[model samples]
Target: MPAAALKPKPLPTQSTAKRPVQLDLPYAPVAKRPLPAGRPREWYVTHNRRLKAMRLAIALLDSGVYVPNQARNETIRSTARRIGVHPPSDTTCHMVRALMRYTR
Candidate 1:
């Protein structure tokens, strides 16, 4: 290919158009589905722990704590509290950091 053909074109400028804000369905109540019956006790524990870790990780990210280092155990616990969740255990906090690390 020719040198000019190989040259990248300049990118277009971003639009400043305002978009409609999406609102949560607070008034539309959704029923919570219970966990499946007959699962092993260990399975339930692991499942709940994973859910807690995911919630903490999402809350941390939303609050501008992207890096795992910034999400210490105390910070994770505080986020959980703010989000109306029980304070995460040490293992859950570690899992939250791991989620953040791998996702990033």
Candidate 2:
């Protein structure tokens, strides 16, 4: 077979028409309220297990009725479970500590 025969034929082109482009009208800006200081917007937006644990911890601390038992890990796990969050782990404890630090 010849090289010319092996080459593919060019595709046919359709006629192009010029049409008017419509631009969207700009709307007026609305005033927005600012988020509270020291707390992150992500904390409210994302409901991750760790954040839930942290929120629970903060609420317990603020209530002034939460007392730690001999087993700290057990207490954390029980509190998390009561609040419908994931079982407490090292990461959850770390998140609670970080949240405590920020609030202080």
What are the lDDT scores of the predictions, listed in order?
0.89, 0.60
Model 2 segments more than 4 A misplaced: 1-50, 62-71
Instruction: Write candidate 1's Cα lDDT for 75-104 as tens digits.
Output: 998889899999888989999999999997
The 10-residue segment with the lowest total lDDT in model 2: 12-21
Q: Give the TM-score of candidate 1.
A: 0.71
The most accurate candidate by TM-score is 1
Candidate 2's clash total is: 0
For model 2, how does the per-residue alpha-carbon lDDT over 14-104 read when each residue is reduced to its tens digit?
4332454454676886796665567676775544655565666765576452443322566666666766776766766656655655655
Local error of candidate 1 at residue 34 (angstroms): 2.1
User: TM-score of every model?
Assistant: 0.71, 0.39
Q: What is the lDDT of residue 1 in candidate 2?
A: 100
Best by lDDT: 1
